[model samples]
Structure formats: C-alpha cells, structure tokens
Target chain A: MTLDLDFHSTLYLIGLIAVFVFALTGALAAAKRELDILAFVFVGIVTGIGGGTIRDLLLRTDQIFWIADPNYLTVCIVASVMTYFFAHWVIKIDRILLWMDAAGIALFAVLGTSKALSYEVAPLIAILMGVISSTLGSAIRDLMIQVKLVIFEPEIYVTACLLGSLSYVVLSHFGINEVYNILLSSGAAFLLRVLAIELDLRFPS
Target chain B: MTLDLDFHSTLYLIGLIAVFVFALTGALAAAKRELDILAFVFVGIVTGIGGGTIRDLLLRTDQIFWIADPNYLTVCIVASVMTYFFAHWVIKIDRILLWMDAAGIALFAVLGTSKALSYEVAPLIAILMGVISSTLGSAIRDLMIQVKLVIFEPEIYVTACLLGSLSYVVLSHFGINEVYNILLSSGAAFLLRVLAIELDLRFPS
Candidate 1:
C-alpha cells in the first residue's frame, strides 16, 4: 500500500490551522488580564502548541511539531500578532471561543490517536494520548491563569476525546478507511463537546 | 537474578521525597508572585507531581505516581501546606531553593532513567526521559508564569541531567554497583548544576 501521503499531509495542514484557531481563542481568553503584547503572544503560543508538544515528547518523536514544521510557529505568531492588534475585536468574539476550542480539540484528539497508533502504541495508550492531546492545550492555558485543572472539572472535555479515540480504534479494527475513521472520530468528539456545552452537562459534584 | 523487591519498595519513597521538595519550591516561588494560599498549594502540587506523571504516561505505566502511592499525594499536600505557612521564612533561605531544585532534579533523573531502562527503552531514550524527569517540574512552573521555556533558554538545566544519565549508562555498562551508579549519577548532576550556576556557565549560544 503506497503510503497515503496526501491524506497524511492534509492532516498535518489541518493541525496547523487548528493551532492558529486555538491561539486566537487563547488570546481572547486573556484579553481582560491587562497583559502586554509579548505576554499575550506568549500565552497564545503556549495555548496553541502546548498539547502537541506534550504529545510528541510522550511519544518520543524525534522532533516536535513546531520544531519540525516552522509553519506552525509562523501561524502561531501571526495569530498572536493579529490578536494583539485586534484585542477588542477578539473580546467581542468570546462567545464563540468554546466552539472554536471544541473544533481544535476534535482535530487534535483524532490526529493524536492516529499518530500514536502509527507509532505502534497499544490502543489503550493511544486513546490516552488522544485525550491528553486534546485537553492539554486548554489545561496549559488554565494553569497559566492559575485555574483548576479542566481535566478534573465538571465539563466533558477529556471524556469526549477519550470516547472519540475509542471510536477510531474500534472502526479501524473493523477495517474502516483511515481517513474516514479520523473524520468520524473527530466529528464524534466535536458533537459530544458541543452538546455537552449546550445542555450544561457536568459531572456531579 | 530475582528482582530486588526491597529496592523496588524504596523507589516509591525516593519519588515521594522528590515530590515534597518540588512542592515546597513551587510554593515558595508562587508566594513571590503574590498568589493566594490555594493557588500556592495548587502550584506546588502541579510542580511536585507533574514530571513523574509525564514520565509515567510516556512509559505507558498504568500507575502514575500519585495514583499508585497516595502517600505522594499526602506528601505533596503537606509540603504545600508547610510552604504556605512558612513561605516568608523559606524565602529568606532563597539561596537554597535552586540547590533544592537541583537535588530534586538529580533524584528524579536517576529514578526516571532506571524506570525507562526497566521498560527496555534504548539508552538514548532513557537519557531523554531522565532529562525530562529532572526538568519537567521547573518547565511547568515557568509555563504557569508564562516565562520563556527554559529548555530553549541558555540555562544548563537539561544539559546537566543528560550528562548525569550518560554517566549512569556508562557505569552500568562497566558493571558498577546499581546503588553506586544511582548515587554517582545524581551527585554528578547536582554538582554540575550548582557549579554551572556559580561559574555562570550556560548552554553555548
């Protein structure tokens, strides 16, 4: 089987776009903090790249995403610069940040799981990586703001990623097309998260 | 040879102490930022448990440190509480914080290397894990404060841990006593870090 070079490359490109969107949401989240531009951009960069960086390190990838692909860095910087110039505009879009975050998480969770499986990790471990890759960026953002861990919070954040990874694994085991598996998995995660938010679903205290 | 159950049992203890040291340093650092007691304790726990947790997840170990040994959680909480009440006093001894951090790094480095080796990872991979274990706590602390990544900085932090792990591998190849290997490796890391600070040595630009 010729390596699905086109499909794999598309995933990488999608990942970079997700990074930009993630950074935009992060920039808006920090708008009220009275931070200087550098600090704002720094937080944005961290929020955008932190999860994948963690995933790469854990997977023992030879080079991390931004290190391997400077395009990711370029996009993050551009997004951050845009945020700095248009903080007021970003602040107005805060209402949509959660959905944007959900989109980013869906992309990350599916891609992370696929990457882990490609590395021949156990399915369970791959699923865990998926959850981590999705939640970790937001987790880093919250930690920087010194908030409680979203992983332990009431939301269905990591849980959605976990279920999505499971779906991918199960579908792949049943011989589903790789691209379709990823799309289905990411869609599952995105819809789950959006529904959870809309319904105000939360873990019981 | 049968696995050394005694040494295995004591490994958790070493990890526990490292967590306590990490927590205390993190709490002290947070206090300097004017964070409240809850924030200080949360920072402490994150600093304490973050590294080992990352290492474990990377190694696919089901038992994370705080999960396997609740004593570590207890230790982290206690250390946080102690630092909270005594931060001002401890800050007076701020000269020692770096050294304490270095010591914790050294301990965790060896522990992490050994664990990686036990999992049959390549020596190079083990060395990387050793460095991650040693430096991950401080990296998380820096990220929380939105500081530039120390790994990207000129600091000799990760370098010292790598050198120590290399020493361990060399000693093991030469059939040195295991305990001596651990001690020598850790001691070397501590000395190298302390000397680097004193001599103002840094990673070459």
Candidate 2:
C-alpha cells in the first residue's frame, strides 16, 4: 500500500533513515571490536550525528539539528543498545544491510546538498557539503574502531556521493522540481554504489 | 623580553599559539607516515582547528572562529609547511615539544571551559567541553594517521585537561577574575602534565 506524505516530511524521513542506518553500522563496528556497551553507544551516536554536525558548523546553522531535537540522539542510543544485544542477527543480514546503507547515504547526500544550496552557499561548497555529510560520520566511526577509512581505499564510494550531490546542484539550477531533483540524483547514486559493490569497482591503480 | 599586552590580546595569542603547536604535531605525524604535502596540509588543518571547532560547535558560537577570521587557518597551514621541512629538527627537540604541547592544551582547555561557562551551560558540560577542546584535535590527528589514541592509553593525558577545566569552572563559580582563573587552572594542568611525563604517570591498570 502506498503511504501519502508531503515533500518536507519525505525529506525528513529520508534523513532520519540515514541517521538510523549509520548508527546501526556504528554499533556493528563496535560489536566487531568486542567493545563495551558504553563504546557501542558512543560510536553509534558519533556515526549517526557527526556528519550533520560538521555540516551545520560549516554552514553556521541557527541551531544544530540533533541538539535542537533530542530524538535523534535517543534513536542512536536505542539503536546501539539493540545492536549490542542482536549483533549476530544484524551480521547475518550483511548484504541487505549494505544495500540499505547505500540507499540511505545516497538520500543523505541529496539532503545535505539541498540544505547548503538553500543557505546560498557556492554550488561547489554545496556539493562538498553533500559528500562530507554522507561520508564523514562513517569515517569517524571506522577511525574510532581502528579500521581503515573507506575514503582511503580504492573504492568508488566518494565518487558516487560526489556525483549525486553534483546532480542535485545541476538539476536544481535547471529549475527542476526539488522532489525530482532528489529522486533522480539519489537514485543514480544508489545504483552506482550498488554496481560498485557487486562488481568491486575501484579507481584504476 | 616580555611585551605588554592586554588581557583579551593575551588570550588571543595563547589560542593562536595552541593552534600552531597542534598543527606542528599534525605535520610531524604526516611526515612520519611519509605522506605527500597535500595530506600533510589537510591533516594539519584538521588537527589545528579541530578542538576549537568542536568547542564552538557544542556551544553554537555566533561564528566559527576560523571561518570568521582566516588568520587561524593561515597559521595552521603555515605551521604545517614549516614542520614538513623542519620535522627532523622539531623531532630532535621532542622533550621540549611535549612540554609546549602540554601547556598549549592546558591553556586551550581553560579557554573552552571559560567559553562554555559564559554561555551558561551546566558546569559539568563546561568541564567536558574544556577537555574536548584540548584533546579532540590531537585525537583526530592520531585517528587520521592510524596511531593509537592517547585517551585509550594508560597515561594521565585527558585527566590533566579535565582537571584544568574543572579548576576554571570552580574558580569562576567562586567569583574569581577570569584572567586569574585562566592562569591558575592552566598552570596547574601544565605542571601536572609535566610531572606525568617525567614520572611516567599512568592510570592504574
């Protein structure tokens, strides 16, 4: 059954989903390290909210989104606790979880770019913000867990996010409806990421 | 010769010095890793401004200090380039550099706590901010370079900063002038750190 939702609400849902997915990944990382409950919670929260926090700081948003709304923090904590207990099950669905994360970050990049554009920043800065928003939280998470950063790897991860953000900026400039801008851009990004995962795409050495 | 300076200017100078010292450490890390110049610059900037950036973000400062004034960024960049070429000389004086970094972070912690207190956050949060300010940049630098985090080490590093910030909060609550509050707290922190290094102080296992 199709659910009816307005544009703003849809965007909000997308952002929330991204945060939740990132938090889960963080918890999973902490679990992989056999860390304590507190570490799980800390990693989850940082992975969930860190990118947006960096974005808001750069843009000088009137209020940091999560700080202004404690719900996001609560969600991260809850996700971490749940993952701490159910890590085995979470790990069992690795492929599906990876796909979900891919979709989540694609949508998140669009949201970040859109937000920056609205703030009247340079288009290049908006694109950079988009990439940063999608990537930084996970990078911080990996760092905390002492894993290699994905960006430092040969993957197409950052390239896909960059293209998605650039697409949003380009489409918006051409007066495309924002809803279309988001869907088309994020859809392309998600597809590229999925292909990369399936084919093990890497930049030529 | 000691040049006379106003209180505000003195604080500004202290902050700038901290940024430069932190940037030097960051560049030295990049040098150790045999990274390219761009990586050196990137890591240096992140390490230099990271702590204060976290502090400003938590407190929602009116403007991000570096973005509002380009001088801080310039200082970090310059310090990184200088260190990249002179890393051997800097390393030769490792003992002196450690002491300088300790003093810099101690002063930085007081600045963070003092700023948070001005915003009227809880005293505990102010103290936490202080520690975050002094410690986070170096933490980020280590993470970037895949070094073991100092906080996770047995050393009394974070403890020193925490005590410094706490001292400032307590003194301010007792109606001490801010200048004296800064001096007493940071001085105590620096002394503690020096003692820790000399005596190989570690948190009891």
Candidate 3:
C-alpha cells in the first residue's frame, strides 16, 4: 500500500482547514474577554497549532509542521486579527461556529491518528493522540483565559474524537481502502459531535 | 568535545532530582486547593515532567525521557502522595519549599540548555527552550489549579530561567569545560531566583 503525493496534500488541506477554524474560535473566545489585539493573535496562534505542535513533538517528527510551513501560523494570525476586528458579525453566527468547531475536531482527529499510525505507535497511543490533537488547543485556550475547562465539563467532546480515531485505526487493521478509511472515520467523529451539540449530550450525571 | 558516559549519567541524576522537586511543589499547590488525592497525583505528574516533556518533543528526541524511563513518573507519584498525607508538616517548612523550587528551576534550566545545544539548535531557540523546560511544568500546574499565574504576575521568574539558559549556551559556545558549564549556568539561574525570593523582585511596573 503506497500513499501518493496527492494523499499528503489532501491531509495538509484538512490540517489547514482545521487550524483556521480553531483559530477563529480562539479569537472569538479572546474577544469575549475584551483583551488587547496582541492577546487575540497569541491566543489564536496557540489555539490554531497547539494540538498539532504537541502531536508532532510527541511523535518526535524531524521538523515541526508549522516550522516547516509557516502558512499555518500565518493563517492563524490572519484569522485571529480578522475576527478581532469583526467579532460582532462573527458572533451573530454562533450556531455556525459550533459546527465549524466540530468539523475542526474531526479533521484534527483524523490527522493526529494517521500521523501516529504512520509512526507505528501502539493503537491505544494513537487513539490518545487523536484526542489530544482535537482537544489540547481549546483546553490550553480555556486555561490561558481562565475559563472553565471544556473537557472537564461533562461533555461528549473527547468521546467523539476517540471514536473517530478508533474507527480509523480499526478499519486500517482490517485492510480497508485508504480513502474510505479516512472519510468513514472522520464522518463518524463529526456525526457524533453534531449529535452531542444538537441533543446536549453528555456523560451521565 | 565528546561527552562521556559519566556526563550522561550525571544529567540523568540531575533530571531525576529536578523531577522530584517539581513534583513536591505541584503536590503542595494541589494540597492548598484541598483537592482529592488523585488530583494531587495528576497535578504532580504534570508539574514533574511537564517541562522536560515539552522540551524533548520540541527538540524532536527519539524518545521522551519519561516514556523511555518510567522512574520519573514513579518519583512524581511518590512525591505527590507523600505530600498529600504530610501537608501539615510541609506547610510548616514553606520557606524550604520555595528554595527547593528554585533549585528545580536551575537544574532544569541546565538540563534543557545542554540538550538543545547537543542538538546544535540556534542560540535564541536554545535559550527559549531552556526557559520553557525549567518553567513550563510549574506554569501548567498553576494554570491547572487556577492560581495567580506565577509567570504572568510581573515577577522575575522567567527572566531567571532566560539568564540561566543563556549563560549555559553562551559558555558552551565559548568552549568552556563541560562541568564548569553546567555548574556556572545552573548557579547563575539559582542565584537570581534566590534574589527574587529574598528581595521580592519584579519587572518594572
């Protein structure tokens, strides 16, 4: 089984999209705090690449993704600055923001899981990598601004990513086709997230 | 100059000692919050290895130190649990805790700097890595517990790390002997931190 150049590029596209969405969410959160513009940018960048940074570092990649391609950082900065200036309009679409964030989680879950699998790490660690990739950015953001931890909140967010990564890794082990593996896995994650949002799902009290 | 087996062993010893000290601080912080025992252990582990974990990941080491050697984790757990059961006595020795934390910072500063320089990273990044390695564990602990951010509190903490790492890297570049490099660099950091404690130093308001 050989992955071509196109496969790598598509993964890159997914990663960039996820980073942008996460960056917007970060800037929005910072805006709510009425912090200065620089704070918005800093928080945005952290939210944008924080997970992937940790992921790459954990996997001990030769070059950090953002360091190798500054576009990710640039996107985060641009998105944050734009949101800082136009948060009023962005806030009007809070419903869309929720979905976009879900998409971001799904995308990052796939990316993190695939990266870990590529390193031939244990499946459990791969699943954990996926969760970390999807969640650490926002967790750091909430911590930085002293907001209640979204993960610690009785939400189904981490579960969605875990299922997504689990599905992908399991399918791969079962000899599924590569393209279908990604789609089905990410779709599973995104669907669970959507359900959680629409139904206010959470861990049982 | 080629580093010998003894040099590596010495670093391992320093790292273990530093991890123990940081773990004690983390457990003490959690004890103040009066959280459960598990929270104390969790926070202790985070505070114990958090800085070195980030440093290794950023440096792209082949294996994370803690993952490669679970002794570090064992030390953190032991330190935290002991602190949990012995908080009253520990609080009576608050003055000693502050100095022990300073020692941890200085030791980690040297460890972080030497690792980066071993990788031959640029000086600016080496200094930053040292600061991150020495401070990030405690920062994560503080953020986790939602105390006043020791780093952001207009204090001289980070500056001490920056200077400590700077001295190590600069001395290394100047062809200083390895033993002197380690001692002087860590000493510089520890001295500055001690001054901050005794004098209540802060950056200009």
Candidate 4:
C-alpha cells in the first residue's frame, strides 16, 4: 500500500531527516580533523542548514527556515554534541553514516527542486538549485576543514542529486502523484549513490 | 570641498572597488596553491561576492545583486584572469593590495550595516551582518586554500569592521549626513586596519 502522508508533511519529514544526517556527516568530518567541541557544533550546524539557507535566500523568502523555527538549529547542535562525545564508537559504524548521507542527499535534491518550482523559477534553474542544496553544505564543511573539495571527488554524489531532481521535475510535469514522484526520484538517486559507493565509481578529471 | 555625490552613487562606487580588490586577493591566494585557471576564477568570484550574497540572502531581497547586474560578475572574472596571468607582478605590489583590501573592508562594513538597517533589522544584528559582509568572503577564500583562518590571526580584522559598522549606525541615528557617516566610519576602519598591519598588532588569543 502507498503511504498516506500529505505533501507538506512528507516534505517536512524528509527535510528533518536530511538535516540530522547531514549534521552527522559534518560532525564526523570535523572529528577527522580533531577539532574542538565548538568546532564540531559549528561545522555541523553550517552543514545541516547551509544549503536550505542558500535556497531560501535565493528565493527571497521572508524568513529563513531555521531562523523561523529554532528547532532545526537545536537538532544540529544536539547531533553535533552527541557525535563529538562518541566519535570513536561512531567511527566504527562509518558505513551506516555513509548510507545515511546518501539518503540525505536524495531527500534534499527533491525538496530543493520542489521549493524552487513553487517559486516559479525556470525548470533548469530549479534542478540546479536541487543539486546545490543537496551538495553545497557538505562542500562548505569540507572547505572549512581544509580537505579536498568533495565536488571534485570521483564519487557520483552530485550526479545522483542531479538525476533525482530531474526525475522529480519530469514526473511533476506529467501530473504524477506527489508520493510516487518523490519515491521514484529519491529511490533512483539513492540507488545510484549506493552503487557508486560499492563499485568505486570515478569521474574522469 | 565635500563630495557632491548622492548616497546611493557613492555606495555603488565603493562597492565596485571592493569587488575588484577582493577578487584580486582571491586570485592571489589561488595562485599560491598552484590552482588551475578555473580554480582561480572560482575563488575570485566567490571571494568578491560571497559576503554580499550572504547579506542579500538573509535580507530576502528579490534578486541577488550580481545576478540582477551581470557587471559585477564580469568585473570578478576579469580581475581574476588579470591576477592569474600577472601574479608575479601582482605579488610585487603586495603593499598596495593590502591597503586596498583595508579600504574594501571598511566600505563593505558600512554598506552591509546600512542595507540591514534599511531592511529594518535590529541594530545589533545589523552590526553583526556588517562584520560578516566585510570579512567572510576573504575568510572563505583562505579556507579554500587551507591557510590558518585570518580571524584567528591577531590582525584585528573583524574588530576593525565591527567598529566601523557601529560608528555608521551611531552616526546615522544622530541624523548625520550620509556622506559624513560613510566617510567617518570607513576612515575609522581603514585606519585601524592599516595600523594593525603596520604595527603587527595581535589580539591576545
């Protein structure tokens, strides 16, 4: 049976999950750098909300999502603190974090595209926004830690987001049900990411 | 004799100068890393516009300044290309670049504060935005190049911007003329930055 969630609620659920997972990845990355607790929180918060903040700004939304609802910021801080204290144990479950990150990327890709579409932006720019929202936060976090840029990595991260966003746009154009559209798009992206991770996919430099 | 330009025109002139100087610094940083031409352009564009972009996004402006006016992007690209090709010569004129950067910081600080006040943001938050606009672009560029954070350095950069923004707000509150407000605030910041650079002033860490 298909899920019965409404459109806005579905978006909210996915967005919250995306924030948590992205924050976890940010904290993990900071842990690798041996940064202080404050640094962990800083990187985590930036990575968690950075993409959506950029999207909201571009859309000229009256209030940024996190600023309007402080709960998102709280989630980021709590996740970061948790990660900082248990980094050693968390590192042991690194594979799980990778998969969670993949899921987060898929969700954000669709959400960003949908938000842009609602704003009546052109479809092409909407897709770009989706890719940007899914990937920019992590990229910024990587920069903060002085690591090699993730966008330049051989992995199929941004490509997965692009395809997912494209799929969502096309499905919506055809008047598909929102549930089916999200599921198909997110599934496609998630599968691509998982395959890339397992198969060691690399783009030519 | 006092200058006769309107507030808006003067702001535009200072903004253009700020973008050019910031782009130059970004290119110089990229050159030290032996980055390719694309990387040079990328860093330069990001450094030149990143702060204002952040400010505009936070204020929920209808269109980002550079996107609405392609001239800003063109300036960034041309400045980046010039710096990349003449990096050796550019490095030799490092003293001039430093002073120019100081001027940029001062101008951006005032501009950022004024924009936020126009949006009716609280004075305290407006002051914070001013500091962010003045310093964040270069900070991001430094991060991309993996250098120690400039804010962490004892150079008093943020402090100078903070004082400048505060001065502007206070002057404006007292019904000072826009020209005088801009000049006094910018002069204060520029002088402070020049002193810090020349005296090797370091804040106690």
Candidate 5:
C-alpha cells in the first residue's frame, strides 16, 4: 500500500508539471496583437491551476495546491516565460503537442481518481472528479479564446477520460495492483483518443 | 420566514433565467462559425449552466443545476434560438444589456451565498462561492475563447460580489430578515459595480 501511494504521488507531480506546460501552450495560442505579459501569466496560471483548484475546493481541502507548494506556481511562471520566448517555434509543433495533451489527459484522470478515492469519496464522484480535472483546463482555455470547447465536440475526448476513470475504479475495486491498473487505464484512454483522431470517429447526434 | 423563503426561491429562478440569457449570448456569438445547430445548443447550454454547475459541485450537491431542473435545459435552447434570431438588433442596445448583466451578478451572488450558508459551509467559503457563481459564466466564456479573464484584472468586479456576500452574512448574523438582507447585499453589489464602471475605479495591482 505504501508503494502504491508513493507511485501515485510521483505520477501526480509529473502530471502537475504537464498541466503547467499545457497552460503555457494555451496562453501562447491565445496571445494575439501584442499580448500583455501579465495577461499571458494570468492565462497560464488559470489554465494550469483551474482543474486542481476546483478539485480541492470541492473536496473541502484547506491546502490549495499552489498555496501549499509554491513550486507549482514557480513552474507556471517558468513555463509561461519559456512559452513567451519560444512561441513561434512551438506553434509549428501544434499537431505533435496534441498527442502530449492526450497523454496529459490520461495522466490527470488517473491521478485525480486516485486522489479523490484517497479522500474517501464514492467511486462515482471520484471518477467524475477525475474527468473534470483532466478536461477542465482545456475547457477553460477554449472559453477564454471564445471558441467552442473541443471536449463538447462529438469526439472521444471526455468520454475517454470517463472510461479511464471507470477502469481505475473497477480495477481498484477488484484489488488489482495499482501500477497495473494505472497503466491499463491510461493506455486505454490514450489509445481511444488516438483512434478517435485517426479514424475520425465521432459521437452521433 | 416562509415568505422570505419564497422570495429567495423567486430570485433563484430569475437568476436562472439570466443564466439562460447568458448561454444564448454564447450561442449567438458562435452563430457565424458554420457550427451545426447542436453545437450552438451545446455552447448555449454550457454558458448558461457552467457557473451554477461549479457552485453546486463546490457545495457538494448531488449532481448539478440543470440535472435537478430540466426546465433549465429548455430555457437554454429557447434562449439560444431567441438570441440567434434577434442578436443583430440586440447588439444595438448593448449598453442597456450591460445593466442587465449587473443585475445577474447581483442576484447570482445573493443566491450563491444563501445556498452556501444553507449547506453550512464556512462564511468565507460562502462568500467565495458567491463570487464564483456571479463571475464563473463569463470566466468560462472567456477561458474557452482564450481571452484574458476580467476577474484577474485591476477591476472591481469580483470585489463587488465579495462585499455583497460579506454584507449578507453580517446582516443575517444580526437577525436581519432574509428578504431585507438579500436586498441590501444585492443592492450594494449592483451599485458598486455600476459606480466602478462609471468612475473607472479599479483594484490597485
């Protein structure tokens, strides 16, 4: 159990780092017509911290992540600065980065579910929180840009996260090894998202 | 007390209607994008429901706003259609509508605070939720469009909601009538917002 907990902790840290990077990507994407530096930082921080903030607030935790560990805030700042400098070069890599986003989704979904379960919430609520943590950053990023959210599209995006959370909950309920459960759930979600993109599979109206 | 409860419930429904209008505004904004009808509906529903959804989730309510009141779903669709058809003319009266938005902020803040207090959350938490319920829809809209959030700016927006929530809590503690408390709190918030806009008063960064 200790090893399981440690593994989840490591995954959570890495997942948070990914959120910072993606938030920077979002800020860069939206920077148009001489973007203000503070605005860029604000967007990056909001996109990065939003999902976890909601998660913590809903869970009634006293320690908000950035407040508890300033490292996350530092990471957001560094990511924003890096994106500000390299935005032109990075913009050319949008397609490849979409896959990174998919990976980030899977990672956050698994990590969120683990955290929610740790708080002794019901499996259903835990799974929902996992999906929210994974999807909300991009949702926020989309709303800020005045675009329709990609998650609300007729695609596998949020559905993949939901399925992944389901997988984790089911495996944990069956006493499966934590590492194996995480791998299976994440892999399943990643593959589904990739397949949806490649095959152009969409939800029916 | 029964009359007061009925009055609060009436305010809540009006707030929901305002949210419906906001959701339709999102749909109308997206109408030129060649989006399918369902896409328009989705955006409208998301815009209308997003704030209260966040509020309910944070309050740990089972499910969310529209989930409990499917009438909100109909309201969103009808409002979206109405906006799409009349937006060309409505855009001409944008200044008047701005005041309507202020009304929305006032009512939502009061309803949000009352609901949070009913849930027995901390006073500070209730105040925060009031702010969230008032500002979250526009925040979601801005985030999705990748626009800078007005809340983080040197604006008095969230400050007004916060002050109103504080007023409600203080008055209620002093055994004020609920209707009078809501009226005082909401009136204060509305006046502050209008004055901030007129006087160009903003937060010092």
Candidate 6:
C-alpha cells in the first residue's frame, strides 16, 4: 500500500503532468487563432514536446523522448482533443491556464536540467537547456499563433525558469536528495511565477 | 585534377549554399521586424539552421550539423551582421531575397531527403522531413517576425519543396547518378518556386 516515488518514477510523473499542461496551453493558444481541430492537435503536440525535443537534440540522445515512448504523444493528443471539445469552457479560465503553465514550466525546467546533467554537460549549459526546455515550447506556440512571446513580455517567465534551474543545479551539487531538489526548485519557480502574475512584477526592460 | 563532386561532398556543398541563402533570408525577415542587430543574428541563426536541426533530431544524428562544424554558425552570423549593416539597401531587393530563399529551399529539401534516406527512414517519412526542412525555417522566421506564414500565402513554397524532395527520392530509386539526381530535383523545385513567384500562383486555401 506504499507509493513508489523513486527518482526515475518521480521524473516520469513530473514529465507526464508537464506535458499535459503544456498541451492544454498549446490548444488554448491555437484556439485563439481560430484554427481547426487538426491545428489544435498539431500545436498541442508541438508545444507539449517541443522543449524536450530540443533538449534531446542538443544532448545527442539516441532517440527523442516521445519517439522512445509513445505515451507522451498520446497524452499531448488527448489533452489537445479534450481542450478542443471544451474550448468555450477552457477559454474562460485564463487564470487557470496561467497557473497550469507555471507548474508545467517548473517541472520541465527541473527535468531538462536533470537530463542535461546526466549527460555530463557543463553546468551553465545544463541550466541554459533547462530554461530553454521550460520556456521555448510556449514561445514557439505563441509564435505559431501570432501572439507576442511571453518571454518578451515585461512579466517574468524565463527568469523564473532560470532561477528554478539554477537552484536545482546548486542543490544537486550539494548532493541534495532528488525529491527535495525537485520540490524546492519547482516550488521556487511556481511561487515566483504566481507572484509575477498577481503583483504585476517584471524585470526591467 | 578533376573537381571532386562525390555524393558526400556534393551534399555538403549544397548544404553550405542553402545555409548561406537561408541566413540571408533570415536577415531579410528580421529587417522587416525592425529588430536590432543582435536580434537579426539570432533570427538568422534560427532560420539558417532550424530546418537541419529538426532533420538531425528526427534522424537521431550524433551531432547537429552546425554544432559539428562551426562554419554554418559563422556563415549565419556573418550574413546577419552584414545584412544588419546594409538593411536599407537589402530591403529594396525583394526579388533577390525571394530567389535566394527559393534556392535555399530547393537545396535544403534535397539535402534533408538525402540524409533521411541515408538513415534508412521510410520513404514517405524522408520526403516529409525533406519538405519540413525546406519550409519550416521560413515558417519559424515569419512567426518570429509576426508575418503571415509563406505556406499560407498563395505562393507555392511547400509544394515546391515537396516536389523537389519527391523527385530526388524517385530519381535515386531509379539508380540515377547522384549529381544528376540532385541537379534535376533541385532545379525542378527552384523552377517551380520561380514560376510561382512570377505568376503569383497560389494553392486554394
């Protein structure tokens, strides 16, 4: 009756949740463009998996995560379809989308950093990859929908990811427990993002 | 001594030319956005290498072509900087940019398909990748600059790439000489793109 939360399983769980949220965001973005059902699915899949795909490419992984396991693709597609069917309901919940996107960013940042570290990349590059993974998907999605890039907005987005990823790398260097590292890093990012949204906090342009 | 034009070298040459032309197109796209010098270089790098990066990832290549050889990055950056300094003059030459972009698309399509085939991907997938590589970079560039996607225009951009890649694969299957295969395929694509531009041809939406 015990839950198995080993590092690998935990990472997988985080990735699954992140993908779902990212896909939802992608579908929402597509909806704003008044695209068709197929476009919804395409944008969902791209936004959900684009970051990890870029990371894997940079790391020279043998196979992309989605290609290695079809589960991620299924999750993205399902999320997209659901959002498509519920577009009216989903579009009304802008706050929910923002928070969900923040959660997805935090998890993806940590996941990307961990994967890069496992590949023995330099610490700085690993951090860059983490930020890239957390933020690039949404950026691509925004571009596809002809919206302003969130990163270019005055509000903090990539900065939160950078901070979260930096904290993860620093904690890992101190030999922190994986669970604690993930929680602390993701928590910090989520908190910062929430604060930025609520308080209109932004980095100086 | 006879000039060496083996398949590998020929492909490399085609790729080099494609990257350069793609960089120019990227710079031109950036100019339209009034992006600063750094943004020009950034967009140029993205547009010049984005397609091949996608191709390499899909093919599970050991290293991205630009990362393996810094020359591609150099070409993109240098082209961007030059275009930035000459933006006023460059903007006047719309026809030149269109032709250069068309050439880049033709070469990249063949190059992408050739690489995918070498990796033993399914013929259909290889062709798809070819079209993606040829067209996606410009799409990304347009997205970055908030311009309408060229693929969505009446112009026959993606169609030209599709035709080019298809011709290359079909010709290769017929045991044609590599030189003739590349020339005929790329020529077909380039010619089609030129015709599309001159005739204002467009696919029905």
Candidate 2: which stretches are off by over 4 Å? A1-5, A199-203, B1-53, B62-131, B134-138, B144-146, B153-205
Instruction: Summing lDDT over every window of 10 consecutive residues in candidate 5 chain B, give the lowest-scoring window.
Output: B29-38
Q: Measured against the native two-chain assembly using Cα atoms, what DockQ does each of the candidate structures obtain, in the order listed?
A: 0.08, 0.13, 0.14, 0.14, 0.11, 0.14
Candidate 1 local lDDT, B121-170, one digit each (tens): 99999988888887787778767755566667787888788878888877
**Tens-digit lDDT string for candidate 3 (B1-205):** 2566777787678778789889988999888876666567667888998999889878878888775666887889889998989988878888887888888898788779888888989999889889999999988998888887677876788888888899998899899988888889889889999999999988997
Weakest 10 consecutive residues of candidate 3 chain B by summed lDDT:
B33-42
Share of reference contacts found in each model: 0.06, 0.12, 0.18, 0.18, 0.12, 0.15
| Tens-digit per-residue lDDT, B53-146, candidate 4 | 8888778777877756656777888889999789999999999998999999999999899989999999998899899888889888877777
Candidate 5 structure quality by residue, lDDT tens digits, B94-159? 666666667778778877898899999998889888888888877766555444776688778888
- Give per-residue CA lDDT, model 1, range A1-205, as digits (tens): 3468877887787888789888886676566576778877887888888888878876777789789878887887788888989988877776586787777888898888888888777676677568668777777877776665565455777767777888888898799998889889999998999999889897442
The C-alpha local distance difference test score for the whole of candidate 2 amounts to 0.85
DockQ of 5: 0.11
For all candidates in order, the CA lDDT equals 0.78, 0.85, 0.85, 0.85, 0.76, 0.84
For model 3, the stretches where C-alpha displacement exceeds 4 angstroms are A1-11, B1-48, B55-60, B67-139, B148-205
Error of 4 at B96 (Å): 1.7
Please, what are the lDDT tens digits per residue for candidate 5 over residues A14-123? Answer: 77667776677667855753467776777777777777777776666668877998877877777777777788877787777767777778877887888888877777
Q: Backbone clash tally for model 2?
A: 0
Candidate 6 residue runs with Cα over 4 Å from true position: A1-7, A36-42, A81-85, A198-205, B1-53, B62-131, B140-146, B152-205
**lDDT per residue (tens digit) for residues A14-68 in model 6:** 7888899899999988777666565676689789988888888788787777766
Candidate 2, residue B56: how far the Cα is off, in Å: 2.1
Give per-residue lDDT, candidate 4, residue A109: 93
* TM-score quality measure for candidate 3: 0.61
